[model samples]
Target: MFRRTFWFTSGVAAGVWATTKVNRKLKQLTPENLAVTAANKAIEAGHRLKDRAVGFALDVRDNMVQREAELGDALGLNAPVADRALPPPRRYAAIENRTGPEHVEGPAHQKNPYNRNEDH
Candidate 1:
């Protein structure tokens, strides 16, 4: 009789444990919980991708600066001011600054040929 009672108690305990475990699992699988988990994972992935893109951009900028320096050295673009070549003196036409008002047809605002409205 003691053996049968012990077995029965053991069976009841096992069933209770199983039911509790299943209930916790079901709660975790609910829609709200699942959506929160998915959103968290998506945000984590976006952060990782942004970090990778920023790293790649930094590397490209570093390489670009290095290449520009190399080219500047190859060409004498980085030479001292005294060593640099100068363009020949140019003879420019003298600019006339007249004091009189600029000649315009009708009112200055009305001279806007781009205006499509005749009412203006």
Candidate 2:
């Protein structure tokens, strides 16, 4: 009778342990928990991306500062390049014709205006 009682108690304990473990797993895998985890990861990735972009900009600025004179000479900038503010974005007028405003209606060949059939 003692052996049967021991076996029964052990079976009950095993069942309880399994129930607790399954409940814990189910709680962890709930939709709310998963969404929260995903959101946290996304926020972390965004922060990392911003950090990398800032670092890249700093590196570019450093390289430009080191090669300021060479770059200025190549680009024909006589004054201090870093001090100069960037020019405002160019505003383009609306195209009113099929040829557009940029298309110059002039002689096809500027070199030889009289030669109409000149290879332009």
Candidate 3:
């Protein structure tokens, strides 16, 4: 009876060990499982990249809008003139104010030393 009980317990332990080893070996040899794991990792990486790209695009768009608003405010182009009567057209000064070597004649012949010929 003692020998039988010892053999039974040893057999059960061996069976359990063999089953565990076989399961481990089978898992190691399974290409489909590895591929599935790799695919899941790639999908997660792609999602992270897409999320970062969307965030960067939104930031750029917001910055562009803010810059445009600031430029419009600085240039006084945000709104139309308040009075109905149109203001006189702005008269640009002649380019001869510099009196440098780069001075040239303008199209209007108004002492334009820059000589930017508009007839072209």
Highest-lDDT candidate: 1
What TM-score would every model get versus the actual structure?
A: 0.59, 0.45, 0.51
Among all candidates shown, the one with the greatest TM-score: 1
User: Candidate 2, residues 9-106: lDDT per residue as tens digits?
Assistant: 99999999999999999998999999998999999999999999999999999998879978877887867778778999998654345454335556
lDDT of 1: 0.84
Clashes of each: 0, 0, 5
RMSD of 3: 9.3
Off by over 4 Å in 3: 1-29, 80-119
Question: What is the lDDT of every predicted structure here?
Answer: 0.84, 0.82, 0.83
Per-candidate alpha-carbon RMSD to the true structure: 11.1, 14.0, 9.3
TM-score of 1: 0.59
For candidate 3, write residues 1-54 as lDDT tens digits.
999999999999999999999999899679998898899999999999999999
Least lDDT summed over 10 consecutive residues: which range in candidate 2? Answer: 109-118
Quote the lDDT for 72 in model 2.
75
